[model samples]
Target: MRPLTNTPTRYSWATILLHWLIALIFIGQLVLGFVMVRIESQRAAFELIQLHKSFGFLLLGLIILRIAWRLGNKAPPLPPSVGALERRTAPLAHLALYAFQLALPLSGWALVSVSTLEIPSMPFNLFVMPNLPLIESDAAEGFWAAVHWYLAYAGAALVALHVAAALRHHFLLRDQVLTRMITPSSAGE
Candidate 1:
């Protein structure tokens, strides 16, 4: 087999941009979640939640673009040392991540839409977002809430694994798997 030293293995420019942007948004969401939900009385907590929701919507739209980009462009292959089991599971895990990332945000968005009370204030009073149009029932609202929570839990769990696996590749395997995303080659860069 060919050696996998520093071989360019990363998404296209657009794909990488989307990947990093979503990551940043997710990080913000995680922090906002801890602060807003945990310390309920803090000033600006509601606003922070709105910020989180808006970022989630951004992530939702970007995710669709990311999926479309993935379909169009061939993704870079796994690095040299990735086990066969990991190679297979990576795609499935990504699939799950994308699904959850999209579902949870959209569900939360829908919850706001179906809510009887005034939706929390967001920037510019442009807070209300478009709904799915199909899922308009109160039951659907509850269902989406459940989906939002469960998927968020699953996504968080997977993120831990994702980070651990990257660490494994970086420290244990001494491979360039993490480097691929971190530093693209001169060609890709």
Candidate 2:
């Protein structure tokens, strides 16, 4: 059986699971965000938006856990073939990823909180989430909405870049970067 925690050279099963789970969910959320807005029916749009919010909340919690896990564990080192620029920028890219992962949800929450519609967010319809104490106004809502929208596009770009880089490592560099996440045992090969 696969190990539960990360080893010195590869991510543990838990980390791999969380990483892909967050990636898939975030991608779904991005697609949903675009599609739901184009929905014609107000009722249909509202339902999809609520689902989006719930998923956002889920992403928020998962990201927090991921960050905590990363902090507590040492990530496997980048391969020696990686250049100095990549080594320097890689951490910055990761930092941006974490920041966007966090900022996207909080901005969404803020957008909903200050919305003129005053719609309460019920994550998965399980419970009503409390709104932030910001003064409710059109300006506040617009600001948060803009923040949320822009951050989402930024996040999409980052995800694309991340994937491209990983592919480069896998196919071009012919390194263990991608394999380590997919098959931990391969890290030792």
Residue pairs clashing in model 2 are none
- What's model 1's TM-score? 0.80
lDDT of 1 by residue, 120-165 (tens): 5353357656554544567766776676667677777877787898
Give the best candidate by lDDT: 2
Q: Summarize candidate 2's per-residue lDDT along 59-133 as a digit string, tens digits.
A: 999999999999987788888888999999999999999999999999998899999898899999999999988
User: How does each model score on TM-score?
Assistant: 0.80, 0.95
Return model 1's CA RMSD, one decimal: 4.8
Stretches off by above 4 angstroms in model 1 are 1-8, 120-128, 134-143
lDDT of 2 at 68: 99
State in Å the error of residue 156, model 1.
Answer: 0.7
What value of lDDT does candidate 2 attain over all alpha carbons? 0.91
